[model samples]
Target: MVEIEYKNARVKLGDPDLVYEPAEDSFLLADAALEDTESGMRILEVGTGSGFVSAVLRANFENVRIIATEINPHAARCAKKNGVEVLRTDLFRGIKPRSPEARFDLILFNPPYLPTSEEEKVPVWLNYAFDGGASGRETLERFFAEVRAYLRPGGRILVLISSITGVEAVQEKMEGLGFDVDIAGRTKVSFEELVVVRGKLS
Candidate 1:
């Protein structure tokens, strides 16, 4: 196990196969978390990975209930270490908003956005954290299909996308789902530009 400090939170990580170590994508999501913190706000973070973003959310919000979901068992343990309630399941599989009387105020996801072919698929679980499948939209397509049920009437979602993931397609799918999509934040590195897209019910 290795301990790394992310933002203002101390996180312990072990076995990369079991969990996806937080990276630039995770930090970008944390930046989005900054704007969503509100007293008693109910938040759900899908793909919690190393639990870094969940930790950041819990630390920054007041009376806000945060729920985390990670498909990886090891990642779920890492999230639990951060002292946040976690559900080990696929994105939004079966989780209730922390506020029972209402739905989620904000839903955050940093999904697998890398386009990978079946030939590149491996037995490693970490691949699930980065492989977005043929068009890099496989996982996201499923996420968008079910996310609306969990969101409040005016709730919002923040998701990360890479230039390689085809941002235009993602925006279109979101728009088709009745969301007004906008880029909330963006950054450029050597190979590609990373974008944080915010979607709200129109």
Candidate 2:
């Protein structure tokens, strides 16, 4: 279990059989986004396990609508239990925009980017957070391709990527996709390299 305080609200998270610290990078990324932009904008939280980010956003942004997505039903349930309206979507596939021209002003994701090992098959419990594909770039690739369609002009995307998964590879992909990317925050934990990257639609 991991605990974090975002916008003065406490959130507790537990994922069985997986080791991870929740919401630190996500909060840093979100704070950067909220600080750098004006408020009352539409926000989307991808992979919203337990609703920590969504709950914090709801508390901070008045007149803002939060659309949270979780691929795992259990996570979705947990998010809803925290008073967030969560959508069950595989990434952005099932999420429909409010209108043909509607797009999110801020998009956030804490994706599963831990590179898998050949010595072990991914455990089912880790599926909600771990199991990034061979190079750990599969989910990021999909987000890069599809997110453009859902992002407003000049909108920003904040995401967490682990150094173990090759941040440079993901950065190159985002650059190739025409995004202006920069590392907004980072923390070097004993066993993990965590960072938050902010991407602006260019």
Residue 199 alpha-carbon offset, candidate 2, angstroms: 0.9
Candidate 1 lDDT, tens digit per residue, 30-97? 98777766888888888988888888877666588888898988788888987879999989878753
* lDDT of every model, 2 decimals: 0.85, 0.75
Clashing pairs in 1: none
Candidate 2 lDDT tens digits, 1-202? 4566767666666564432335466666566656654566888888887777777777676688888988877677767766788888888878865553479988888887877665544546456577677787678778888887888888888888888878888778777777899997888867778887888885
lDDT of 2 at 99: 51
Name the candidate that leads on lDDT.
Answer: 1
Q: RMSD (Cα, Å) of candidate 2? A: 2.7
